[model samples]
Target: MAKTKTQTATPAPHTRTRTHRALLAAQLSNSVGDGAFYVTSALYFSRIVGLSAPQIGAGLAVAWGIGSLAGVPLGHLADRRGPRGSAVLLALATSAAVASFLLIRSFVPFLLAAALYATAQSGLAAARQALLAGLVEPGARVGMLARLQATLNAGLAVGAALGGLALSLGTRRAYLAVFALDALGFLVCALLLRGLPPLPGAPAASGDEPRLVVLRDRPYAVLTLLNALLLLRLPLLSLALPLWIVQRTSAPGWTVSALFVLNTGAVMLFQVRAARSVTGLPEATRAVGRSGLVMLASCAVFALTAVGLGPWPTVAVLVLGAVLQVVAEMRHSAGSWQIGFALAPADRIGQYQGFYGTGVPLARTLGPLLVTTLLIGWGVPGWLVLGAVFLVAGLVTGPAVRWAEHVRSRAAAPAAGELVKAN
Candidate 1:
């Protein structure tokens, strides 16, 4: 007694296309409001709440580290149970954390709220990405991912602008309002996900696959490791770069906020075309490699900002660095997502997403400490060190990409399929 491929399969077209779009829109809304909180929170705590910059950075690093450890099990849970449930819980947790800002203005309470928010961020990211994979046609995943990222950056720009506006309002109440808006965004995102048709959970099929099986896939494994380094450079830019500008270049806090606005605004404008440029590329591995190169170049720009440029020149350098960072972010996000979707079994997307997502949060945990420490000890020289680390890490991962190319080539040869869209 034999089984047909179709009969043995779980299902085709697990959810409708519009459902995916709804999820993406919700994500964009959440990111726009949430993004502002991170950049501004550090500043607010340091300048307004009366903490030292180093102390604030250290606290964030510790909170992020704790959240990263928590994410693994949460990811696994999303895989076993369902992301819809997780998404709802995430929304609730975020709401509570944001509201807690009003009641407990101390450092310890802030740390607890930050940790909770980070955990929610990790869970939502994994669940949303995995859910999208289930809902979309496989060939369109990269484009969808880019669109998702572009939406997020756009939302971030809006959020940052609003936060800046709140600062101008000059009251604790305004700040609390901003946090409340962010919480509401999370709630909206959860509601949107809940309305979508059921996405397949990891346990329903291929229940025998162990978590470690993903690690055996060397190409993916290697890329995940390299991403750990890439993720570090961004926070350096987000947290450290602005601080550097304000302290060293005679710029105000507004100047730093303006620079971020430029960074995110550029992504919103150019991300679509950049995403399309590699869409028909031959191999996913090379596409991802190209993304690495873009990132390497951007890190160089960021490292040079500490050399004491005049105000406009400083802004220009910051803009250039931001441009490269966003470009690289767009490309890397697309390619990495493509890789995740391609490597995942149709049945267990949640588990794979959980494993894959560990890189970004883990990088966040480590990057701030490294960049802050370097900045304290050596200023501009520290950024050079950071840039070098990213460049070397990216180059070292090339061999694994080559492996992926070889594997994909074999898979495509027999079917003579059109090349999958490049990320």
Candidate 2:
């Protein structure tokens, strides 16, 4: 992709239109429920539902795997039937799944409910993205996404606190209440979505075109894979860092909570600002490239924590690493939003967004095992290798995006000529 002319001035920051407010409200409502569930779900399953830890983990793994496969078809449904309706329906389905969890006692019932939950959530995400793309201007979509991210973190924080209260009580009633709250949140989300302005569905594909056209788009597939690789960072803080702190560093276990707080608080405060300058594809790619280098530096700093430093010194170094990591995270997120929306075919935005969104679940599913093995099992060398992986993935994103653009341009050329002749 040759450099496109950059905007000379920064655009005014995104203001909360009614649609924006509705979207943010829906996101916050559901995320709060999700946050509470995240903190309580494991114990709920073990203590209340009588499942073994291994059983819980295996069931969730299978659920998300199936969810990942279900996204594309569900997103295609959004394109054919309108995004707002699809999103609303999926939200209700998600609520139903959460409600079912209250009745699930056996492993098989838990697995089935979990799968439904995951699938509905995945489809809901894709439909929401498609709705965002339709309603928001191209230039402001990233800004809107940044705001949504901030709202999500805020809601999660509040939900986590509520979940902590439930954990303190440690009763079956308390656990059930958390699940009930989560289900209610999704119900509210659906109601909010129902009020949004409807968007027309995409036109049907011509007879010659495949029904699932995204499956055949090789360049976009490559882009999605590269993005997924960069997303390995998703589990680093959640899964890998706590283990690294406890086993590898002199830092106290409390440092894990501190790091989590730092991450969520920083994102809530700064994510929108970090995304302000990413006005177009060129800027977006540059931001992604910069994020890679920053992530590499953070990784290197983390590696230093294992060098027999005093506890305070390890904590200080870990804090610095975390700051760098969060900065990288914000920039990468901004750039990703830009690329994901810009490169997708306008008519097929629902399916394309669904496919692109798969990177999240993929990262979540595979990242823990991979990151833990590299960081915990291999030690310092693992950190360095992981940094290199991030660096390469970030650098490769530029080429992958350009390849996608080139293919899109080539595909559009004949269409333009045919229009010219018809005129």
Candidate 3:
């Protein structure tokens, strides 16, 4: 008599627990480095590396574009090989890429290094998501992701302060030190990943299963696009709001930094709580819908700042808007995690997550231009349109998710019947 699946899986509670902690620790370590790198990279390139602003911008844009295309194949590699090893290798590659930046004195070297860094970061993200899916129970993945988000925010805050210190020093040595710190962080991330239990590679694809099944997944692709639209919020605070505050509103210059601090602090404190109630697809969709409404309200509040308010009044309005935006950000993040994980096939989690993760780079690439144009060039009406976009995307998520679920279920039915017949 053979045992059922549960009967054969009773001894790994402790291992799972350790894997969870390891994932959180790894996220914190790398995110801190990313924070410092993001804050100082432009200055380092211009002041120390002798690169023009346009050159640096072009290099990174091209790098992330290449990275977006690389994610699917690399994710497929993770699925065919093993996520742990893939993740470890990619982390090391990322560290190497960052180190290369320190030595790059020309445009070509910077471009190559930046591309490698982007590709490795993209692949590492996909592999880690797959690893998390393998190690954690399906029901708990969202909560775990929320905790990771909180940890990431906390780490980034600390790293940002360190970056600020380096910026104030404004020396060649200080800039080099920040880059070195980023390299070291990724190195540490690689080591932490190496310690995790190795998961088996996914079984070989059958003749019917295409190597890149995710590419053929239309419903999942639709959801991915919709999620990408929502992710336009990525540049809202960083690019749009700052410009809005500086050019349009009467808020003090420091209000921009204050708003950023408010957003990060709010996420660190409340993200897990925001995610706690979102346990399934229905809840996830609802959370997203609610977030859109809140985001719309926040947009309205931000628009009010343009009406010739006093400095304190403008600051107050900005803070209120920032608070609302962060709340929406937290909820949208939680819901998107649940949807991305739930829609993916268990065996193809790596490739699926990799494809899903493209939304980030897509947002990064297109979001600044789109957000700045809408929020700054178009002004109040633009805010309304942006809010409407969020609202529509959130509203449509439920139907899109249902479509994906239906397709996935339909695809699974034949396999289920085949299993039953064999048994």
Candidate 4:
């Protein structure tokens, strides 16, 4: 709250000359399906299809791993063929993959279905991000991203409620109905993309440009790695803290639900407002650095929960930690958006965004194991070490992004000289 007091005024979404109401509407529709499918996927496989827990888990792990690897290539495709058309085609393809689940039963079929779904989902995300980059001005990007996050939360709530209603019916037909609706949602999203302005394919860069620019950009790679670490904040809230409360802390179990509500509600209310002040690279990097400090403070507070306090005292500390982590998340996310966009070459944003997108699914894939091991295995010392990690990473972000900018400038200089000499 104190950090974002110096915000530049940004236009309201409705006021912009953009017809992104369709895009926002598409995100809302897609996210609702995501929430429902995610919540019901395991149940659908377990109860209706009769697959065991370990079977589904292994398949999903493999699928997500494969999908993460595909992001770079698929993103390159988007750059070559225009994100608008690629996004539409991929979204429709994803819809077909989702509907295929109705026939999957055993391990092999399930694995194939999961792989197809996961790959399409990852590609769609990269395409949509690239599409968004083409759709909105850079200055307004973070605010729009913030609004999308908020919309996702709202859609999740609605979809979760729908899933609950479906679950209460306890029939195979009921589960199938949810799956069908989720597929339909994607189809609708594809239709929505058809209405957006055409985004022309990016022209190939000069032969002097590195063949695989994103892969060779070492500084951006480091920045991507750091962002991956910061993304651990998600698993901390979703996976680790809940289990920690049950296993280690004296806090009442209800704090789990309460803390999640706090995190979600806070983001819904404050994320866009917080992102407003971060309109450029310098401010973006500072916000990223501050997020680390806030995260460190949050971790320290969470560690206090294990200090043999009464349940109420423990609950208070847990809530405070939750609040701080959410603030840290909002700050870091805004910074990430700014840096990611500003650093990418305008023509190859899709490829670069795909490269950056790898960090997220990779983090989601690995974070659960890492955080649980550190927090649950080493206890308070572990939490302190994690805080130090956040502090160091956050503080390093600005320098790293600036260094990346310098590298880009150096890379472009020779090309500029070549063109002048030819003239």
Q: Rate the local accuracy (lDDT) of all candidates.
A: 0.67, 0.90, 0.88, 0.84
lDDT of 4 at 312: 93
- Over 1-423, each residue of candidate 3 has an lDDT whose tens digit, in order, gives 211121112227787788789999999998888888889999999988899989987898899988988898888899879888999999999999999998999999999999999999999999999888877888788999999999998888888889999999999888888889889999999999999877777776766658998999998898888888888888998879999999999889999899889988988899999999999999999988888888888888999998998999889888999888999999999999999988887778889999999999999888888989998999999999998988888888899999998998897798788888889
> What is the clash count of model 2?
0
TM-score of each: 0.80, 0.96, 0.96, 0.92
lDDT of 1 by residue, 285-335 (tens): 565666667766776776676677766776777778777777767666666
Q: Judge candidate 2 against the unseen true structure and give its global Cα lDDT, from 0 to 1.
A: 0.90
Report the lDDT tens digits of candidate 2 across residue range 1-423. Answer: 211221212323353377789999999999999989999999999999999999998898889888888888898899888899999999999999999999998999999999999999989998998888777877789999999999999999999999999999999999999999999999999999999878788777777779888999998898788788889988999889999999998999999989999999999999999999999999999999889889999999999999999999999999999999999999999998999889887777778888988898899888888999999999999999999988988898899889988998998798778878878
**Candidate 1 error regions (>4 Å):** 1-17, 43-55, 105-108, 204-219, 246-255, 277-282, 299-318, 373-376, 379-384, 402-423
| Residue 106 in candidate 2, Cα distance off native in Å | 1.2
Q: Compute the lDDT for candidate 3.
A: 0.88
Clashes counted in candidate 3 amount to 0
Positional deviation of residue 387's Cα in model 3 after best superposition, in angstroms = 1.0
lDDT-best of 2 and 3? 2
Preferred candidate (TM-score higher): 2 or 4: 2
Native-referenced Cα lDDT, model 1: 0.67
